[model samples]
Structure formats: structure tokens, C-alpha cells
Target: MQKKAGVGFYVFLVIFVFVIMFPFLWILLSSVKPLSELFGDQAFTWFTSNPTIQSYISVFTIRPFHLYLWNSLVVATVTTVYTVFVAAFAAYAIARLRFRGKAIILGVVLSVSMFPQIATISPIYIFLRNIGLTNSHLGLIIPYTTFALPLSIWLLVTFFRKIPFDLEESAKMDGASMMQTYFRIILPLAVPGIFTTAILVFIAAWNEFLFALVINTAEDYKTVPVGIGMFQGQYTIPWGEISAATVIVTIPLVIMVLLFQRRIVSGLTSGAVKE
Candidate 1:
């Protein structure tokens, strides 16, 4: 019975995988096709015959893809770094220490996470504008980190609780201070969780469009998503070049996820099952 169930699960997984991958496969194929073929109705039939990379070159020649790439990398990297550090410390304190209103604070974090980002956009925009952060990278960075920080803390707290407090006690007994314990023992064990959180933050910040569009007005400051959208006008969208850029953006996330698949799975499952 167990063997039969395992085979059935594998079959289901294979079908689901194909279902999810087909559209992306089609997009990738279309990206390499000529604009004429791409814009034509029978473009799907031309997928196997000829593939052209001219569309990829056109985006760079016609638009500032390099600047967009640089902006995305910088913003995502900064946001990831800030979120991981801030979230780790917050999670540690919440998980390991006893304090008044701790439950209430956690509840508030949960509530904030549940709030729709779109609903609060105007208020955030006003606040950022008032503080001279509007149209600056720091403006988006601050808010992205703030919005992502809560979920990071929540995920890390779940992982932290799985760690034995006795390890912390042992460090304390060995003449190591609280900071020492955090920096040495607890942090090493939490590396997997930290990485998972960083990837999540990077992906979220990288894909964010509304906040980036609203806060960053300059061409050089625009992230990839906004940059790509700018390619579309009222009448026409460059499907060929747009598809190529879409594929380009997806590759990094795909590689990163595959590379860290084990760590991500272990961290999430451990946190969920044990915590």
C-alpha cells in the first residue's frame, strides 16, 4: 500500500510539474522568436523551426536594461541584508527572552503582516515624502525592509524555538556573554533559516512594482519590473523583447532556489514541525 501510494504521488507530481512549466516554456520559446513571428497569430507553431536572439539585443539597444539590472541588484541586496539582520535579532529576543507584552507584540506583527500593502500605499507615500525619502532608493529600501521584516522575524522565531535553550545556558556558563551566545552558537545553527529569509526578501523586493513605481521616478533608479513595464505603451507592447526580459529576470531566482532547495526545505520543515 505504501509503495502504491508513493508511485501515485510521483505521477501526480510529474503532471503538476508539467502543468506549471509549460507556460514558462512557451514564453521562453517566444522570446527568442522574431518580432514579426511573435506578433503573428501562428507564433506558437514557429517555436520549433527558428529561434532568434535579436529581441534580447534590441531591449539593451533600445532601452536602459543595464541600469535597471544594477538598480534591482542593489535594492534587493540591501533589503535582504537589512531584513536578515533586523529579523534575526528581533526573532532571537522574542524567542529567547521573557518580557512584558511579548504576546501582544507578536500579535501586532501578525496583524501588520495580514494588512494589505495596497491599502496603506497612500499613507506610506505621504510619510516618505514628508521625510524627504520620496524618489530615493532609501525610501523604497526602508519600506520594503519594514514590510518584509515582520514575516522574516516570524519565520526566524519559529526556527529559533526549535533550538535548545540549554545551548544558550551552556554558553552563559562558559563565561560567554549574551551577545557572544547569539553571535556564536545560536547564529551558526540559524544560518539555514537566515539564508531562506534572505532569498524570500530578495525575491519580494526584486518583483515589487507598485512601491518601486510610486517612489522611484528616475530611469536610472527604476527596478527591473518597472523598467520592463515602461516598454509597454498605450497601443503596443513589445511581446518579443518583453518575453526575453521576463525570462532573464526569472533565471536568477530559479538558480538560487535550486541551489538552496535543501536548506530552504530543511529550515521551513524543521521550524514548522518542531516549533
Candidate 2:
């Protein structure tokens, strides 16, 4: 029975991986296919007789894809950094300190994160317009950070709670101030959690569509996701160019996940396992 179950699990895993990877594989293959072959009357197939780099070149030349890439990087990086830094303090307080309404506050934060961006877009748009922040990176960054904060705080708080309280008490005994202990002791120990939270925040900000679209309306400030969506050829959508753009944007994320898979796994599981 155990042998049969193990074989079943492997089969399931293989199917799951294929399902998850199929779209990405399609995008990747389509990106390299020539326009003639891509749009030919022949039924679409995985095989392409002629592949060209024209789609990739067009992605950059036809639109400000480079600028869009830069905007995504800047916005995602800044939002991740600021959100994680701020959430660190909030998470630390919730994890280590005894205070009134802490549970309520944490619950509210989680609840806020659960709200879809669609629900908040109208008010957010009005606020940005009123502040004259529309069409600017700062406009997008603010909302991105706001949305990312709850998850960041929740993850960090869970990780922080897992840390031994004895280290904190020892820091206090050694004449460290509260801030000093946080900076010197607790924060260092929570590096894994911080990194994991940062990556999640960065990815969220990177792929965010609605907030990026509504907040940054100008070509100069648009992110990759929005820019890619704009690949239209008057008559129809440019599938080849869109595929290329997707492949380009997806590569970075794949590389990041591969490079940090170990740390991400460790950080994610570390807090979940308690004695």
C-alpha cells in the first residue's frame, strides 16, 4: 500500500509540475517563433520551423520597454525595502511587546491585506489625484508599500515569535536599550524572515497590475506588466511581442527564485515548526 501511494504521489507531482509549467513553456516557445509561423493558418503547434529575435527587438524598440523595466525595478525595490523595514518594527512590537489591542491590530492588518485591490482602487485613485501624485513612481510606490505591509508584518511577526525570548532578555540584562536590543539582537536573528518577506514583497510589487495601471498612467512611469499589455498593432494584439515581453519579465523572477530557493524554503518553514 505504501509503495502504491508513493508511486501515485510521484505521478501527481509530475502532472502538477507540467500543469504549472505549461503556460510558461508556451510563452517561451512562442516568443522565439517567427510572426509568419506564429500567425500562419496552420494549427498552432509546439514546433516552429523558423525562430527569430525580431519579437524581442521589437519589444524594446516599439515601446519604452527598457524604461518600463527600469520603473518596475525601482518601484519594486523601493517598496520592498521600505515595506519590510517598517513592518520589521511593527512585527517586532507585536511579537515581543505586551500591549493593549495587539491582537486586534494584527487581525486588522491581516484583514486589510485580504481586501482585493479592486475594492480600494476608487478611493486610492481619488487620493492620488488629490495629492497630484498621479503618473509618478511615488504614487505607485506608496500604494504598493501599503498593500505589501500587512503580509510583510504578518510573516515577520510569525518569524519573530519563533525566536527565543531568552536572547532578548539577555540583551536587556547586558544593558542594551530596547532599540539597541532590537537593532543588535532580534533583527539579526530574523534575517531569514526579513529576506523572505522582502522577496515576496518585491514579487508582489513587480507583477502588480491594477494599482500600477491606475496609479501610473504615463508611459514614462509604467511598469513591465502594464507595458507588455500595451503591445497592440492597431488591428490586433501583437502576440509575438507580448510573448517576448513575458519571457523577458519572467526570466528575472525565475532566476531570483532559483538563487534563493533554499533561503526561501528555510525561512518559510522555520516559523511554522514550533517545539
Candidate 3:
């Protein structure tokens, strides 16, 4: 009975992983296929007999996809750095300091994130337009940081709270100022959490579409998502190039996650159990 249950669980896990990975696998296969195979009678075929790098080449040559990628990298990187920095301070205050309405403040910060992007996009667009930030990297960075903050703050707060208060007390006894303690002690100990938060924020900013689409209509400021959307020509949709672009854009994120997956898991699980 035990053996049978274990076999069933492994089978279930395999199926679950396949289901999750199927779309990416399909897209990858599609990316390598030539346009002929893509539109040919065997278009629905899972395996392409003629695999070529033409689509990948076309992704760069046909459109300014590289520029879009650069734009996304800049915006996401800036957003992640700024968001994590601000959230660290805000979270430390919430986690360590005694203050009034702390719960209410945290709740309000979270509630801001819950507001639908669609609902707020109009006002946000108007504000950015008035400030002459539309179609600029700063425009996207600002909004990305805004939406990223609540989650960053919440996660950092959990990590900060998990830290022993004795550390801070000792730092104070050693004549460390609040800033010194925060910079030297609290932030250092929360490296895993900060790394995890930064990754999440970067991914969010990278994949953001609605605001990127609406605010930055210029070719110069277009991100990967926007660039992929514009891959369609007047008469034909370049499925091959779209797939190739998807694969290209996705590789960095996959590599990032795989590289730091251990830290991510550690950060997520660190504060779960009471010390």
C-alpha cells in the first residue's frame, strides 16, 4: 500500500510539471521552426523536422527587438533597485519601531496594491502626461516601483521581524545610530529577503504590459512585451518570430531564477517558523 501511494504521487507530480511546462515547451519548439513549417500542413505537428535559427535571426533584424529588450532591462533594473531600497527602510520602521496605526498603515499600503491597474491607469497616465514623463523610462519605473512597494515592504517586514531584537539592542549599546544599525546590521542580515524581493520586483516590472503599452507609445521606449505585440504585419502574423522573441526574452528570466533559486527558497521559508 505504501509503495502504491508513493508511485501515484510521483506520477501525479510528473503530470503536474508537464502541464506547467507545456506552454513554454510549445513556444520553444515553435521558435526553432521555419515559417514554412509554421504555416505548412504540419503546422500543428509537435516536432519540427526542419529546425532553423532563421526566426531567431529575424527577431533581431526585422524589428528593433534588441532596443525593446534594453528598454525593459533599464526600467526593470531601476525599478527593482529603487523599490527594494525604499521598501527596506519602510519595512524596518514597521517591523522594529513602535508607532501608532502601524497595522493601519501596512493595511493601506497593501490596499494600494490591490487596486486594479486598469482602474488606476487612467489617472496615472494623466499624471505622467502632465509631468512630461510619458514615453520615458522613468514613467514606467515610477509606476513599477509604486506597485512593487507593498509586496517588497511586506516581505521585508516579515524578514526583519524574524531577526532577533537583541541584535538591534546590542548595536544601540555599542553607540550605533539608527542609520548605522540599519545599514550595517539589519540590511546585511536580510540579504536573502532583499535578493528575493528584488528578483520578484524585477520580474514584475519586466513583464508589465498594460501600463507599458498605454504610457510608452514611442518605439524608443517600448519594452519586450510591447515589441512582441507589434510583431504582426499588415497581412500576416509572424508566429515564428513571435515565438522566437518569446523564447529570447524568457531565457534571461529562466536563467536568473535557476541561478538564485536556492536563495529564493531560503528567503521565502526563512521566516515561516517562529524562532
Candidate 4:
């Protein structure tokens, strides 16, 4: 009976995996097809008549895809590092340090996350403009960190709070300073939470479109998503190249998340289960 249940579960999971992956599989296959062949309505299949790498090359030559890739990498990396760094300290403070109004402070930060990003755009635009960060990577990074930091803090703090205070007390009794204990011990134990927050923030900054479009005017400053949008000329959109670029851009992120899947899942479930 139990074996039958296990078999049923595997079957369901197989079906679900195919359902989730079919669209991406379709996209990857279509990306390699020649534009001419792709346009005509034909029964969709895994094969294309004239699969070529021309679309991929055109992305680099026609528009500076490499430069845009660099831009995105710089901004995403900076935002992730800054968000995690700030969130780590803030989370530690809230979770372990004796402080007044910790609940209220943390609650306010969480509440801020509930606010729609669109609501903050005007102020963010004006602020960045005044600082001459508009059309710059710093502009995107700053706002991305701000948007991601609150949530990172919440995730890390929640996870940290679940950890027993005994370790911290033991460290303190051994004459290790608070900062030393935090940096050496507490931070190591919270690896899963940090990775989890980094993944979330990385995805947000990597995929942010509206802010990227509004803030950056130069081709050099645009991210892959915004740069891909520009592939649509006054006359046409290069769906083949666009799809190829999409696939290319998505690969690194997918790989990173998969590599860290266990830690991310552990972090996400740790505090929620309280075990």
C-alpha cells in the first residue's frame, strides 16, 4: 500500500515537472530557429528547419549585449552584497542584542515591505537624480539594496531568532566580544538564511525592469532585460535573438539557485517550523 502511494507521488511529480518546464523548453528550442522559418505558422516541435547561432551573435554585435551583461552583473552583485551585509548586522541586532522596541522596529521594517514598489518610484527617482546617480549603475544598486534590505533583514532576523541563545551566552562568557561572536559563530550558523536572502535580492535586482527603464538612459547602463527590450527596432522585434538572449541570461541564475537549493530551502523552512 505504501509503495503504491510512493509510485503515485512520483507520477504526479513527473507530470508537474513537465507542465512547469514545457514553456521554457519551447522558448529554448524556438530561440535557435531562423527568424524566417519561425514566422510561418507550423506545428510546434522541438526541431527547427534552420537552427543557427546568428541570433546569439547579433545580440553582441548589433547591440552591446556584453556591456549590458556587465552592467547587470555589477549592479546585481553590488546590491546583493550590500543588502546581505546590512541585513546581517541588523538581523543580529534585532535577534540577539538587548534593545528597546525591537518588535516595533522590526514590525515597521516588515510593514514597509508590504508597500508597493511603484509607490516609491517618484521619491527614488528624485533622490537619485539629486545625487547625480541617475543613468548610473549606482542608481540601480542603491534602490535595489533599499528594496531588498528590509526583506533580507526580516528573513535573517526570523531565522536568527529561532536559534537558541545559549551559543551566544557561551561565547560571551568565554570573553569573546559581541561583534566577534556574531561575526565568527552566529553568522556561520545563519549561512542558509544569508544565502536565501541573497537569492531573493539577486533575483529582484536581476529582473527589475520598470526601475531600470526609468532610471537608465544609456545603452551601457541598461540591464539585460531592458537591453533586450531595445532589440525591438522601429520596424521589428528580433524574437529569435531575444529568445536566445533570454535563455542565455537565465542560465546563470538558474544554475546558482539549483546549486544552493538545499541551503535556500533549509533557510526558508527553518524558522517557520521552529524545530
Compared with the true structure, all predictions reach lDDT values of 0.82, 0.87, 0.87, 0.83
lDDT of 1 by residue, 1-275 (tens): 34546788889999999899887888898898777786657675746457789878977887788889988888888988988888899899999988888799888888887878788889899999999888678888887865688778878888788789999998899999889999999999988778877776677788888889998888878889999888864577888888888898888878987998887676557535752
lDDT of 4 by residue, 1-275 (tens): 44546788889999999999887888888888877766766526569876888888888888799998999889988998888898888898998898899999998887887888788889999999998999898989877765788878888887788778999889999999888998888988988678888887777888888889989978889998899877775566678878888898878877987898887776567546765
C-alpha positional error of residue 175 in candidate 3 after TM-score superposition, expressed in Å = 2.8
Task: Predict model 4's lDDT versus the native.
Answer: 0.83
For candidate 3, the TM-score is 0.91
Give the poorly placed runs of model 4, Cα more than 4 Å off: 1-9, 43-45, 267-275
TM values, all candidates: 0.89, 0.90, 0.91, 0.90
Ranking by lDDT: 2, 3, 4, 1
How displaced is residue 120 in candidate 1, in Å?
2.5
In model 3, what lDDT does residue 118 have? 91
Quote model 1's TM-score.
0.89
lDDT of 2 by residue, 26-89 (tens): 9899988888777766328887877789999998988789999999999999999998989999
Higher-TM-score candidate of 1 and 3: 3
Higher-scoring candidate on lDDT, 1 or 3: 3
Clashes within 3 Å, all models in order:
0, 0, 0, 0
lDDT value, candidate 2, whole model: 0.87
Q: What is candidate 4's CA lDDT for residue 154?
A: 80
